[model samples]
Target: MDSSAKPILVTGGTGYVGGRLIPRLLAGGHRVRALARSPERLHCRPWGGHARLEIAAGDALDRDAFVRAARGCGAAYYLIHSMNAHKGRFADADRRAADNMVAAARQNHLSRIIYLGGLGQQNHEALSHHLKSRHEVERILQAGPAPVTNLRAAMILGSGSASFEMLRYLVDRLPVMITPRWVRTPCQPIAIGNVLDYLQGCLGVDQTVGQTFDIGGPDILTYRDLIHMYAREAGLRQRLIIPVPVLTPWLSAKWVHLVTPVPASIAQPLAEGLSIPVVCRDHRIRNLVPVTIMDARQTIRNALARIRQEQVDTCWFDGGGSLPPEWTTCGDADYAGGTVLGGAHRIVLEGDARLVWSTVRTIGGKNGWYFAQSLWRLRGLLDRMVGGPGLRRGRRHPSDLRVGDGLDFWRVIALDPPKRLLLLAEMKTPGDALLEFMISPQGTDKVELKMISRFLPRGLAGILYWYALLPTHRWLFEGMLRAVARKTGLPVTHGPEKAAMTSALECRL
Candidate 1:
């Protein structure tokens, strides 16, 4: 197949890399067919509406579904991984997925398969499960009838890359950290731009087929060096690091889980791989691809620039299947009734419901939370310390709220103007949460504003967490509702005055 003909199939369409890669492919004038397990999730992408893009909904493990997605493609990109899939036997699952992909590619008469794997020079037997799974997937793709262009890379520096996010949170949150031995491990990290360039350059490139290239940045640095450089770039003070040998991969993962937005399960494999040095050994791709590689410092600076502008195109959280299987049903919260646990507050205000709704839309982002800006900032900082999105991902637009839009760390799940607005918590939490605001007209010149905070706790910890924050919730939620009322030109009252206002509002109802 030639570059100009046939659609390029992308398997992990909603993933961190694939989500960003599709836009680049579309801009390069190539038709893209993206295969996803949940097509509805793809609709949330900024490039989901591109005319040249086609989205195929199906799981890669389903042979028939996989073949259908790959049928009209000349080449396919196997970007899917099962590491964070929550399935205990991820390696076996990955093997099955790769086998299915190979069969689909062969059945569909595809020309080539391009894959992005991990960078490691260690023997396969000595490599960590994560890196080994990547290598195993590469080998499986190579065994197929079609030639495979495999690009192996280490830590990818970007605003939304998982590795970058983990580093970003660690450096930002900790001043003195007791790190694992891997902190001193030397590695060659690559920028996401360079990685994308390599992936795109391989397409229909004769020299790249049937070849494997090790990709990295212009300079090599230790993991400690990376943290220091990131701190300097972020204008933070030098962070003190004490490397300890006793922190096993499990303990390190738990540490990372507590400090960053990455869950323990996902962080475990990543933390384990850090023990192996990942410097790139091959420079052949640079000669063939004709792309400039940014050094470590420059890459970190670029990622910071993107973060400051809030122009992050995609994030590690964009991947759909990372959440637990039970949490998946939380999407049905819009249809689900009642608050399992949380606070409910209501205020009757003298204003148009539209104006009140408008005020609600501007609650987050640059407008800041209405009642207490510092408190919200503190909450965001604490969330960031615990590996959450914090307040960085602000609203997509200042005055617009839509389903699936990320407002700070909250995702808009239900948006009904002048009536109801619902948000699902995307921050790291012990329980699933849903925050909803409703504005209803009591009569002319009177509107009832209701705020409901709900949480479906996971276990004893989740229940304890809810009750522990009950006092804070009462203070914050009550104040927030009153603040909203004040913003809508309503009168504020307390104690007996509040009781009088409530009676008056009740009469209007």
Candidate 2:
């Protein structure tokens, strides 16, 4: 079979880099197979239904599933990473995942594996666990039977990236910032566009096969320099930065957690990585791929423009487990084991389902929750203090939603247009929680809108937490339903009545 004829397999199809790469490959006329844990999450991507693209449901850690997905592919892009896992366990997960990839590559007879790795000296004493794990994965892949192409990069600067977001939030929110010594460490940052170009370029260039290359932009600047550049690009005044040697990476991460949408779990590793200089040691790939490199200023400008225009293709938050909790779909209420506590409020609005649905879809983000604006802000602040996502992440699109898109601190788990939208809370809570909205058409012109909030408690604390907030929850739900009706420009015909959890479950059925 011709090498180009066989589909190219991409491992982290739903990730920040992988998500953007798939569309580019398809545009290049390559047959592409995207491997993801939840195939449903890929269904809403712009290129999700492309004629040349195929999505295979699998996890990189699952050897059997990985092998099955790689069976017929000629070459694979190893974009998978374990940074989203628990702090100390991510390194272990990355090791196991790389082992699985090596076995799968050998068993499936793949010709090449292209991996994107972090940039840092392998033997550097200051190297963080994240960089070490990346280096370890590169070694594991190179030891396999198939040839591997490793492209090492430092911080990626683009809209919707974790690094960019952290930079953006910090600079935008704080005019005067207390700092860490790592802020002065020199580093090279690459734009997402150039990274994608190099990735695609490697596929067709035989010279790139079985080779390792360091890739970065033209400028090598410190974090402080990047921050100043970002402020200039965003039309903001110069920031007052106080660099202190006493602030450890852990403390820096905690500070980032409170100031930005990035949680401590992700910020900590990133913070530790900055302590080491990550300038590119090899420039061989630059000539091999020969693409225009964007400087820090231009990169920040482009990212800001994308954000303002709401054209961010993928986000760092998009990379996580999006599968709905088991209790959400269980047939019986008792099947959830313990009592499932919930509150449901319904209102009959005098409008077509489409009109009501239009208002429902625009619930979060700048639109703001229909009622209790102050309360929402307070909750977001509290969530941030506890290392949660808070409401700062916001939604990808103003009025459109996909299964994996982040809406404030809630993730869209199930979305059905003109009918139902289910969101799972990513905020710190004692129990698992879900907020669901169902719109059912009435006799003729009217539609019944129902809002349900469910909580599967963890233990005694969870139960106490639910009861304490039950009154507030009821008020918020009722007010939100009424507000939605008012926004739809429709008269409320029936009561903003409280319903049972059973009714909410029945509506799903």
Candidate 3:
């Protein structure tokens, strides 16, 4: 089969693996179709505008929509999983999703379904829910009329992978740590590049169809070894790790939540899965797809290199909020009427919308929040003192913003260039907060800039916190808007002119 000639379907196109895979597939001369719940979200991807790529918007659980996306595609990649789902619900959701995909593939007469699952030696009864769910998903995919190629892998060492990010933050933040006994479990991990190679190499290979492969790297190491290796590569001092047998996975997950950028929901399952050994039992994949797998030290070095170059392609947070599965569906709503307090400011600028947006994307880190640099630094210091992320993370690229990219103490939740940018607060706070900027064209020569800061307080403490900072936010945000206008080298419109500009901006959007 000439695989590149037929259109291929890629589900979970907005995720870490899927996002990177699309570009590789495209570069290999394959026509691709991505099935996204909201196709507009895929716009944030680097290859969003590729000529050979088609985006089909629909939910995976909807059989009809899944079938529509699979229509006319030769092969499909199932990279979807509910990492943020509740403990009791994720497995069921995974099963249903796989079943839906199977029905779609059978209905559309697709050649095969390619799935990426977990690597583990434990049987169904011994596996953790997370790993068991992965195995179940693979079985469900194959139960259909189409042949399924399942690739099972353990921790994928890469710059922006979830496992890598968790390790990065934990190792960087803690000098002396208390860990669970499962940290000593043996496992064979794989590098993301090698994993991608196998996925691409399997495309038209007859041996890969309806086959299950255990893929791993050259080195076999424990979680403790992985962390120590990361510290050595990053030039950090040796960390003192004390392991205790009593710390349950739930408790370990909560500890992970407090220390890393990953949330409790996703961390819990990961922590649980650490108890099982995920080593590859055989090297059969080498015969069909030959690729050099790097050792742990080399993998860490490669991941660090990407970070230093500010070239992290996709992060685990790209799909949206870390806490809830439903948060990804909250699109463009700036208002939270009930308990959320909001501070908003709008200004009219006599410059191109593109210039104004360029200014917006470049705020924070060395650029220093555009205005009130001292106040911002002071706040960062206070946050760091309290064990918060502060503003130290800076950003990957000064002028580029992608979903899930870290900017100082905030994470980019949404980015629509020359139009909108939404950031979620990742600092130690009593409540959830979002800072948003919306830029709309006001005729050909002007633009309207709306900056809104919103806080959803947790309780009395959160309520008190919002009101206490209201005055500071008002002053800072108002001045920031003016600074942005200044960056465009444009004059700010006055009272009457502001109204006219607003009218034009409203019409354009």
Which structure among the candidates has the greatest lDDT? 2
Ranking by lDDT: 2, 3, 1
lDDT of 1 at 442: 77
Task: Provide TM-scores for the models.
Answer: 0.78, 0.97, 0.82
Off by over 4 Å in 3: 1-4, 85-88, 122-126, 322-343, 347-355, 364-397, 403-416, 422-435, 439-448, 453-473, 482-509
lDDT of 1 by residue, 1-509 (tens): 56458999999877778988889999999999999876756665667788998999788889899999998799888888865624578898889999999999889888899999998864845578878888899989988998999999988888778789889989999999998898888888999999899999898478998899999998888889999999999999999999998998888887877677666667777777778888888799988998888888988899889878767777775664222224334344532433356556777776688988989988898888898789888888788776676775566557755455667878776566768877778777887887778787877877777777767787788888889988787678778887777777765332111111111111110
Name the lDDT value of residue 253 in candidate 2: 88
Clashing pairs counted in every model = 2, 0, 0
At residue 170, candidate 1 shows an lDDT of 92
What is candidate 2's local distance difference test score? 0.89
Q: In candidate 1, residue 40 scores what lDDT?
A: 51
Which parts of model 2 have CA positions greater than 4 angstroms off? Answer: 330-333, 503-509
Q: Which parts of model 1 are misplaced by more than 4 Å?
A: 1-3, 85-87, 122-125, 321-421, 424-434, 437-479, 487-509
Q: Where does the lowest 10-residue lDDT sum fall in candidate 2?
A: 500-509
- Residue pairs in clash, model 2: none
Q: Is candidate 1 or candidate 2 better by TM-score?
A: 2
Which residue pairs collide, candidate 3?
none
Top candidate when judged by TM-score against the true structure = 2
